[model samples]
Target: MNIVDLLPAILAVIVGLVVLVWSADKFVDGAVGVAKFCGMSTLLIGMVIVGFGTSAPEMVVSALSAVQGNPQLALGNAYGSNIANIALILGVTALISPILVQRSVLKKDLPLLIGVTVLSILLLLDGDVSRLDGVVFLAVFFGVMGFNIWKEKKSANKATEPAEAGELAEVSESAEKPMSLGKSIFWLVLGMGLLVASSRALVWGAVDIAHSLGVSDLLIGLTIVAIGTSLPELASSIAAARKGEDDLAVGNIIGSNLFNTLMVVGIAASISPMNQIDGEVLYRDMPLMGILTLSLLVLGFRRKGDGRINRVAGIVLLLVYVAYLTILGLKTTGVL
Candidate 1:
């Protein structure tokens, strides 16, 4: 492609990346600010809203791709995002500082993540994810989310500490400020609009970049697009790790993966049925995802007192991700 023809694609990538990061930050800040204002517990906000916010990029990209009638691309974005969230995002975050797993996450969220993964695979058994499958997935998503909220309410009631109640009351009072709900809604809408536009731009730019570079769309989707969309997860996890909120880092990654499977892929397939798994997805991508999930499970099981993912495990995860990318590159070039 000539330089002039390449201009829009190049600019699209740059602009999309910038917009994705900015929009994610705005979305998170606004959501957390509002939640704190409402006197929500940190555990509740972290489990639901923050987790959902971090995965927003993947959801938007997948939904847009599905709406654009590219089910394969949408499916790739979902599965690829899961892989990146686990291997690259968690790996990088743990490298910053080993993440600790919270008991609630281990007992509740992690199993739910595994169940969603297995359910996703089962739904694809017919070689297509029909609209009905999407409904089923979403039903499960809502059910899980509702259950978590209920659990949080129960936990809060049982929390008898005066200091804890005071802290929550203070947070709620801050949330009770006079800021217009309309303004908050506007920010939310604006951020979502930017995310949708940028996702489309990134997908289009990625397709062009792949063709120009003689790379397969699958490879592009797995590497560049996947990592770009996963930027929010990487950043959030690392920040949480630096603050020694290891549970948040681990929970964020786990929650993102769960959302990608249940919400992102579910919505995408609901809009347009995704066809059978592509050769790359079956041979390389799905296996890679399964491997990473298995690794996380093993790590969790081997946890010492604090259930931390150690530096050695972090290095191993990062190496596995790099090796997977290398394999994808080789397959794209017909060398595998």
Candidate 2:
């Protein structure tokens, strides 16, 4: 592609990434503010609203790509975002400060994330994601979410322990106070609108860049688009870590990865079935995703020192991410 042809796509990517991050922040802020105003418990707001809001970019981009007849882009975006969320975002967050794992996360969220990751990989093992498979994934997604909400409700009722109270205090202390109802609603709507627009621009740029360079859309989605869409998580996690909200930072990654692996992919496949899954996706990307998820689960189990991910572990995860990117780069350069 000539410079004239390349410039627009590159510009779209740059602009889209910026807007997507901005909109995601706005969406989370508005949703959190409104949820708190509505008298929702801090646990529920943290568990449900923030989780879904962070994954919004992946959902929108994948849906748009699937509708536009680019299932590769859709699938890649979901799975790639999953990979990046854990490997890249968590790695960076841990490097900033060792992330302390909550017992709830280790026992509940991490296991569910692993199960979902494995389930997604198994579905793609056959080289296609049929509508039936999509339905199955969606069924599991909703079932898991329903059970989680129930469990959280139970915990909310039964828990008034000192540690629990302390955690709740931290959450409440960090949460912003309510604004006028009208302003909250406005930000919610505007954020959703901007998210959709930015996702469209991102997918278009990624697909165009893929085509122009004779690279697979899957690769483009896996690398550029995935990282772009995940910027919000990276930003949020780092900020949370800096504030010493280690549980919040780690929980954000777990929740976002779960949503990406299940809900985002399920919605995309149900919208437009991916009839031909890429071989590399099964052999390459999915394995890496599984490895990262498993690594997090193992590291999170508190054998010593409050089950935290230290700087050494952070560096290791970062190196793994860099190695994955290097492999993709080589593939693009005809060296792999």
Candidate 3:
């Protein structure tokens, strides 16, 4: 492709990623600020509110794509985001700081994540996610949400004084800044607007680049669009990690994956059945997703390592992701 045609797409991706990251930070801050003002528990805010915010892009995009009859794009976006959440997002976050898994996350969240991944694969094995399948997914998603609420309550009751004090300290810190309700709400709206805008720009640029390179839309959705949409998770996770909020960093990834698997796909399929999904989804992408989930399960439960993903592990994850992308590129270019 000529430089004149290629340059704008490249610039769009760069600018989109930058803006997405900034907007996510603002979004999280405003959310946290408002939640604290309302006297919500830190655990609840982190677990439920922020988690949903980060996955909003995938949900919206998938829903619209499904309605537009581009089921592959919808399906690819969800599955591809899950893959990106684990391999690309977590890998990069761990590289920035070794992620220490919370005991609660290891015990409950990790296992649920694996189970959900397997469930998603089973649904897709028949080569379509029908409305019935979507109903099942939504059932599981709501079940998981209820379980999370129960877990949070139990944790709250059992929380030690030190942990409670730490949470309060965080709340107090936010209180010190004292964001006015109007400003907090303003940031929330503005951040969401910018998020959608940036996501569109990123997707448009990625699609343009893919078309110019003769890459199929499915592959484009899986690679460029997937990564573009996942920028929010990557940014939020890395920001949390740098601040030593280890649990939040890891939790964000887990929550986003669950949302992608259950909510995004479920809503999309229920709106308009996704039929005749590419065979690669079954034989290739689904297996890769399952394997990555299994790998995370094993890596996250290391008795010797205290559930830590070190830089070495990070590099390994990144390499696996790179290899997966390379294979996709080869296949898209008819080299495979």
Reference-based lDDT, each prediction:
0.72, 0.75, 0.78
Candidate 2 residue lDDT tens string, 1-336: 797988898899889878876775665556555655665443344446556766887788778888998867767777777788888988988888888887667776788888888888888888999888888988998898788777766765565454576798898799765676678767766765676677668778877888898987757755766576776677656655775656556767777777787788888889889986888988998999999999997877775445788888888888988898989888877897
Question: How do the predictions measure up, each by TM-score?
Answer: 0.75, 0.75, 0.81
Which segments of model 3 are wrong by more than 4 Å?
1-17, 31-47, 157-192, 202-223, 304-306
Give the top-scoring candidate (TM-score): 3
Residue 97 lDDT in model 1? 86
What does each candidate score in C-alpha RMSD? Answer: 4.8, 5.3, 4.2
Model 1 ranges with Cα > 4 A deviation? 1-43, 161-222, 302-304
* 1-336 per-residue lDDT for model 3 (tens digits): 897989998898788878887887776666556655654443345556556777888788888988998756777777778788888988998998998886666777788889999899888888989999988989999998888777666755565445677787886788667677787777766775777678678878879988998987878765776677777777777766776667667767778778888998899889999888899988988898889888887777766535888888788899988998999888877899
Q: Which ten residues in a row have the lowest lDDT in candidate 1?
A: 27-36
For residue 291, model 3's alpha carbon misses the true position, in angstroms, by 1.2
**Predicted candidate 1 versus true structure: per-residue lDDT over 41-138, tens digit per residue:** 54455556657876776777778888899867777778878888888888887777877766556666777777778787777766688999989989
Clashing pairs in 2: none
